[model samples]
Target: MNLALVFESGDYVLIGVFLVMVLMSVVTWSVVILRIIKLYQAKQGNTAAKQAVMESASLEEAAKKVQGMTAPIGTLTADAIAAYRNYRNTEAKTLAEALPLNEYLVSQIRSSMSRSMRQFDGGMTSLASIGATAPFIGLFGTVWGIYHALINISQSGQMSIAAVAGPIGEALVATAAGLFVAIPAVLAYNFLNRSNKTIKQDLDAFAHDLHVRLLNQKD
Candidate 1:
């Protein structure tokens, strides 16, 4: 069928649906690529932060290594060091005398991890909404195409390959387009969500080690 025939009836709705699908596709890809990059950087930064802490002779040296660092692991380590120092410096107490210092450091580290998880999960809700609604939106276009074809058939009293194919083809394309937009969205959401869970586990583990290291920090 010629493409012109598909546009003969009320195709504005189809065009609108196509535009929406295109918009959804663009946003979905943008989120997927950006989040993947962020997760990778966080993972690398976490490794670098762990190495810096383990190799340093003192917590102060570790803090220097992570100074000005912006990654989640780096930030958490830096914050813990700061919290420990603030507690000792303010109370004029040595590390041995800072009884609640461990608890305070753990609380601060947990807060940082919570913030990191939230950051990692940014834009997930939008991805989910796109996945959940794209197919229905596409289906709406298909139903309209079929309805438009039926209206033409009823008006002209004809049903030939040429007469029926244009609308049916357009409807099928609409349905396929819907699935096309939705499939990637659903996959990305699931994959990224799983990656985030793994990242949170890593962060929690780092926090435990950091707390122990801070407790052993020297003056």
Candidate 2:
């Protein structure tokens, strides 16, 4: 009835389940690391681009200055500036005349921001699904183990600790493996969700700033 002996006698399928759980954990960690790096880079690039845009003399000047830069923030800024320039060139004098144009332009910028957000959020859904399902998968394995153990017990008519220990140990190991896979995956999913929210907030702020600048130009 020693734990070591129980494990040694446990089914190999249970060990395989534990190995799969470990692999899932590794994959989840890898995704988290990659996403963190990407989000950090995008945030830094966006801050720099926003600073450059604010410091520029005019929308056209800002566009020209940031033309070569490629980041979600930079692209949004460029689109806003271009829309404003196009509206001005058409020389629509009244606020009513320009409002529609401004709205259309902002819509374009918003759509671009949304697309970029989706790109940044890649692989997060899969991670979430894995987090939600891994424990259940492990549970399924445990149930299978337990069923087999009970069958062996019934057939052998030996209800002693030695007869029941190995299968029970294997079943419990599946539960442990399930937790090992699920915990970090759930944490990563939450972290990425928060990060996405922050990014969306930054995009919204940028859009509002652009709208304010356009209104000031009309004044």
Q: Which candidate's TM-score is highest?
A: 1
Give the clashing residue pairs of candidate 2, or none: none
Total clashing pairs for each candidate:
0, 0
User: What are the runs in model 2 whose C-alpha is more than 4 Å off?
Assistant: 1-16, 88-99
Kindly list the per-residue Cα lDDT of model 1 for residues 143-212, writing each as its tens digit: 9988887898879988888878766786767778889999999999999999998988888888887788
Q: Candidate 1: deviation at residue 193, Å?
A: 0.8
TM-score of every model versus the real structure:
0.89, 0.82
Worst 10 residues of 1 by lDDT: 1-10
**Local distance difference test, candidate 1:** 0.84
Score each candidate by Cα lDDT: 0.84, 0.78
* Cα lDDT of model 2 by residue, 87-113, tens digit: 767764655335676676667677778
